[model samples]
Target: MPDAQKMFERITLPRDAGLPVSLCNVSKTYRTGFGLPVHALNLVSLRVPSGQALAITGPSGSGKSTLLHLVGAMDTPDEGSITVGELELARLQERERAAFRSQIGFVFQRFHLLPALTALDNVAAPLLPLKVGFDKQQRARELLAAVGLSGRERDLPSHLSGGEQQRVAIARALVNSPGLLFADEPTGDLDSRTGAKVMGALLELRSKRGLTLLIATHDAGLASRCDRVIELLDGQIVSDSEG
Candidate 1:
């Protein structure tokens, strides 16, 4: 019988239209509580394509969070380089770093919402550092409604449930329409059902807006939902598999 199909693999996809993030030999070290040097990331190099949802999965203390921080330009690496698009983070001044951060959205497991500020104000905080005025308020409210928090816009973080708070954080992250979105254990604080809902919201954003995503999580189920999973062990990538 004739061959029915070719078994060869297809060509690798070209890089996305715009650069999202690049890390070259990045490493980070910290002083442990016992005063000994602890390696968080060791010569880790990675490139996150624009509009791809990538997950970094590892156990606690495996440097996943540290990597996320570096990618988002929230913290500088102790060694090597991290460049987002054409901007080299290490070479930029503090003010420039802050500006770059404004272009990236970040979500944390702790929610990190202000106790005094309403959800609307919390989402509007990122715009405060920028000079863009008047429109920021409207943008914040719009984003909050987009994340399904329309009725709870005036509620404080303390009044919102864990899932609601995470959704609010998502709105805050997207308020600036950041080119990159970083979430560190975004669903770790919620129950399984709520976690799934939050993950759905994130996936929806990635699909609708072409947002680049880097999610750090220990939940295997959540990681499996991403397009690719990079597994880390002892500050090193043990496996990178496409989903």
Candidate 2:
């Protein structure tokens, strides 16, 4: 086990627990160079109970990524508030947000692994900067193996298949044993069959770890596997249903 495994285990991964997240009247707007406004989210509000697996499905420009970004604390909304457990995202200062982010894991549709790093190093990257008491490489190894990448730890991102790279991103996201995980198009870049396998692995990991999962994806197959699914249109929740 890595130091992070022990150090943050109690803080992040309590038994049968995950961060409960909520948004109230959340809105985001972006302006182009010409000063026209694009409303990403308009008065959006939702509640996700702890350990619930929720999916966000919508077409392009439907505010899927914007919602994730706001909930993930990567960006702030123009109005309203977001609460996760006891913390309010809009109120966290820059430095506080950085520290708060350790409890959150995000996997983008595009695998953003550093091109120069091997799979192990990429997975171990987040722990390298922390003062953890356990071996970081060992933690990385365990995560890689959990994602069915035990023997390929030495492969660089460019050398791996699309699904493998996505798994590596997932491994990296879970390296900290985050209480919450956000995945945008978790399987978008893979073949339908491969995408299904990757989503299965992600959902299995989510359940095994008791993580509150939020995923935004266009693939209906991917969305249908979650505990709940909400579809977005023009930045609003058009449909919320059981997945």
**Candidate 2: where is the Cα deviation over 4 Å?**
1-16
Q: At residue 1, what lDDT does model 1 achieve?
A: 21
Q: Once model 2 is optimally superposed onto the true structure by TM-score, how far is the C-alpha of residue 175 displaced, in angstroms? A: 0.9
Reference-based lDDT, each prediction: 0.82, 0.88
Cα shift from native, residue 21, model 2 (Å): 0.6
Q: Worst lDDT window (10 residues) for model 2?
A: 6-15
My TM-score estimates for the predictions, one after another, are: 0.87, 0.92
The backbone clash count of each candidate, in order, is 0, 1
lDDT of 2 by residue, 32-81 (tens): 89999999999999999999899999899999999998988888999999
Please give the range of 10 consecutive residues that has the lowest summed lDDT in model 1.
Answer: 4-13
All candidates: CA RMSD (Å): 11.7, 3.5
Once model 1 is optimally superposed onto the true structure by TM-score, how far is the C-alpha of residue 135 displaced, in angstroms?
1.6
